[model samples]
Target: MSDAAVPDLTELLADSPTNWGKWGPDDEVGSLNYLTAEQVLAGAAQIKKGKVFTLQRLIGDPKGDPVWPGRNPAVREMTLDESHWDEGNNGPAFPGGMHCADDTLTASLQGSTQYDALGHVWYDGKIWNGFDARTTIGGLSKASVAPIAERGDAGRAVLLDIARHRGKEYLEPYETFTHEDLVACAEAQGTPIRPRDILVVRTNHLQLFFEKGDKFYSDFCEAGLVYSPELVSWFQEMEIPNLVTDTIANEVTMDPHNGAALVLHSALMRNLGVAFTEICDLEKLATDCADDGTYSFFYVAAPLKISEATGSPVNPVAIK
Candidate 1:
């Protein structure tokens, strides 16, 4: 294709990590292709005790706390028809019909446990697999989050508890890790990441939020993986496909690769095409894994099929 037709996304692709044509030209699911039937089967095989862990947080408004400026916390309004109300207060939801209630939910999909669609991140004017974001900017149209639901988000999930491995309950905010640190954690935790596995790294990034509440967690910076070209390269080399964390931003706020500025997101989500999951509640799962000496589980997540949308909310489950 001529430069005019293609727009020379080579520099953007080269500068950041990407999976432009890895699956194919028309591919929209990005690295999600890694979760194949075989991969799904492998995930299923890991379930021994049939124990289950819900990895999503209880998503409610932070008691009306201003978590972020302008972004409204999720609000749930429940309604019951007057016909359902009875004599005093315990009346049936419906006078003649069965009692029923309805809820209207206003949510920030990515506010809690969620998988970020490939379309959710873009660089150099294009998305993964060469989709022009300008034309497909209609959220779920181009690289929509809905496809993640089709894929079933089912696979093997491995938790690399960095804090536990380091003999601590949590890493201090702003503590970041390089590729070597990941490898070390893998070794220390005895968790080997296999291809086609979904990786969940727990750095105890959410401890502050739990201990001190939203104000402290929102006010302060947090610790996470050190973002760098080298870290991106490591993910590509391992081909693990997806990563979720108990972190608001999957990586630390500052860039470690000489100031690439969210290059970690670009490399992993945009370039390499790994569907990224963020803000997951991994505290319970981490504790369970550490107690049982098990880190592998069958993981399942299905994002809302909001067609052409940039991203959607999800509640991923881990079956032990």
Candidate 2:
């Protein structure tokens, strides 16, 4: 179909489900509310081996940090070093003339492994939980990532190595999966996705980005969950608090069925209030899970507390 034939997001998701007002009118974290203390305890119970894996990709990797198109990778510039304290030079004189290195980083908050606030995306002039889009004018005054960072997120997490499940090194561009596919992948991995579990999926798609450089963006659709009404409903029923994936966006770049861009962003995040944790490096976690035949683990992620920001960088950990 031509671009003109595709329905607008409003029309496409007009009748879709939403959790707005389900947690009350002022709720900012959305489905994350499902992560109760009971859930945290349940997650802790899964940590039998004490093996820990960090999921954040390097901020300034020489190989190149993969990010969403139109965003630049992070850059760290050193401001003070040993040279600053050279013979005649002075570096921050203290009681004992102490010297230390200092640096500053500049980059988009969502450039690396991140957690996007509920208000990051929207349609019909409204954001998550019926907040007006104007609330995001200067900065996200409503549904910002600060609330999530303040609260923190921890719970049971299950890894679904979709690439390995299908016997591929990595999923191809525009490759798609559904809730059914997630379930099938989990079953094949000898586990089941419990309700309120943080879903971590691995595709290792960035391997191509590191290998091909700019050519990776020539056709930039990512391999991830595709949106459908049934898929949205499934997420609603499952009470999933967070969706973590090794992809730029947590869903396919464009809906293959309707040609809509990041449909799940609006459907699942905006409507259902599901938190999105994207661009994770799940190689270590997936490798351990595959080797041990244990896919469930205790997952904890605490993003930076930048007020009213759309997202924040995070170094999540998975313990088995």
Candidate 3:
């Protein structure tokens, strides 16, 4: 084909009918087969050429005085009931002690290093692909989220350092990042976005949260650091399949009127049939990879097999 007639990656994805018609009620969205184990291994090999950055926080007891005035589940103590164990002559006589862990867990929701499934968000009481938000988040299983599952291995991954692009490591309170800001960052980095590509936005929020403590969380919520609806529409039009960022929620900020925060979660996860990753520490990854280039990697994640849970804690890795 002539250069003018040749379709780019974004155009090809946008033009695919399978991509557009894959959403259905009876399907599994998050499954291991999304990207085969072999594919994941290959991506890891490529990433090994450089250092592999870990994005997960240590899942242990919370530390330090709660300085951030936000809901933090990680700060809650994990408790175990020894009564469940069988009493032995000297101690509990059982191969393994039976105990229940504390449930009051809170930590970073969107930005601490996690993946947002298609069922993660809801708009007007409806989830992405028209799944009932109340029913799906409360009862759906991985097998039930199949429409999302078939389109697995969301092709390619792109990282954008908005904070660095603007000449700072952190954004001030209420500093809204518009779609133009993202495009400009891509332009500055000389990397154009492609469809089915997983886009990671680095706000350095996690670094600020770790360094400044709880004040950063309070200020972040008060300041409204999120993407606009127009920006969400841009991703949908571009046919990008995934979005990730270091924030509490996918939306730029919480809406007080409807008690909805992170509207982008609704727009993308619920409306655009796109998956999202939250609480990701992309600063290191972006720095290691350098923002001027795109990386073809295999993304892997295993969510807890909890039926009907709103969301489960997951550990996701990007192998390039």
RMSD of each: 5.5, 1.0, 9.7
lDDT of 2 at 165: 94
Stretches > 4 Å off in candidate 3: 1-22, 25-50, 61-72, 75-89, 92-112, 133-154, 217-229, 254-260, 291-298
Clashes of 1: 12
Error of 1 at 175 (Å): 1.4
Task: Order the numbered candidates by lDDT, best leading.
Answer: 2, 1, 3
Best by TM-score: 2
Task: State the TM-score for model 2.
Answer: 0.98
TM-score of each: 0.86, 0.98, 0.67
Worst 10 residues of 1 by lDDT: 61-70
Question: Best candidate per lDDT, number?
Answer: 2
In candidate 2, what are the lDDT values of residues 121-156, reduced to their tens digit? 999999999999999999999999999999999999
Clashes in model 2: which pairs? none
- Per-residue lDDT of candidate 3, residues 174-251 (tens digit): 566766777788787776665445667777655555666656665356323354446656766676656666655544
The deviation in Å at residue 78 for candidate 3 is 7.8
Q: After superposition, how far is residue 306 of candidate 2 from its true place, in Å?
A: 0.6
Model 2 residue 235 distance off true place after TM-score fit, in angstroms = 0.4
